[model samples]
Target: MQIDPRGPRFAAVLTSAVLAASLITDSGVLLAVQALVFALGAAGRSPYSLLFRAVVRPRLAPPAELEDARPPRFAQCVGLAFALFGLLGHLTGTAWLALAATGLALAAAFLNAAFDYCLGCEFYLLLHRARPRPGT
Candidate 1:
């Protein structure tokens, strides 16, 4: 499925806010909640996405082009991985680890939201390029 290019960026902005809160408060619960949101997004079942579709998308002109959904979905999975690591760090009493994980996630989210850059999507492309070709 294809999606409006703005959809993922909108979700990124939301993710960045929650992540910022988690870092600022040093709250494990907030981190975990953010992780759940990322997981839902990765699975293409996010409430945020739904809200954006129903309420936000209609307000703007349609996108100039639709993008394949896989890139954004892959980005979400990377985001979920980071959130999981942050959760683990919090649960294990490793402050540095948790901060690092959440910090990385926040940076990525900020980049996506502010610049429309998707590190996870770029990683996905790199991984595909690294794969051995079939019928070689």
Candidate 2:
């Protein structure tokens, strides 16, 4: 499926806010909520993206280009992994680990939101390129 490239960036903005709040308040529950969002996104049903479509997109002009959904879905999976790691740290009483993992997630979200640079998407592309092909 193709998606408006802006949708993921919008989601990233919201994600950055949520992750930052989770880190600042040290709220495991909040982080868990974000994890759920990541899970949903990975499954191709991102709430943030839905919100963007319903609420935000209507107000703006149409996107210049659409993107394949797979990369963003993979990016969501990566976010889910980091969020789970952070949640584990919270559960295990490892403050540094929790903060570090959450911080890393926030950094990536911020990058996407601010710079349109999705590290996870780039990684997905890299891995996609590296996979063996049938005729290689």
**How do the residues 71-105 of candidate 2 rate in per-residue lDDT, one tens digit apiece?**
99999999999999999999999999899999999
List residue ranges in candidate 2 displaced over 4 A: none
Worst 10 residues of 1 by lDDT: 40-49
- Assess each prediction's global lDDT (C-alpha) against the native: 0.92, 0.97
Return the TM-score for each candidate structure. 0.97, 0.98
Q: Per-residue alpha-carbon lDDT of model 1 for 1-136, expressed as tens digits? A: 9999998899889999999999999999999998888888889998778989999999999899999888888988999999999999999999998999999999999999999999998998899899999898
Off by over 4 Å in 1: none
Alpha carbon deviation, residue 18, candidate 1 (Å): 0.3
Candidate 1 colliding pairs: none
Q: Supply the global lDDT for candidate 2.
A: 0.97
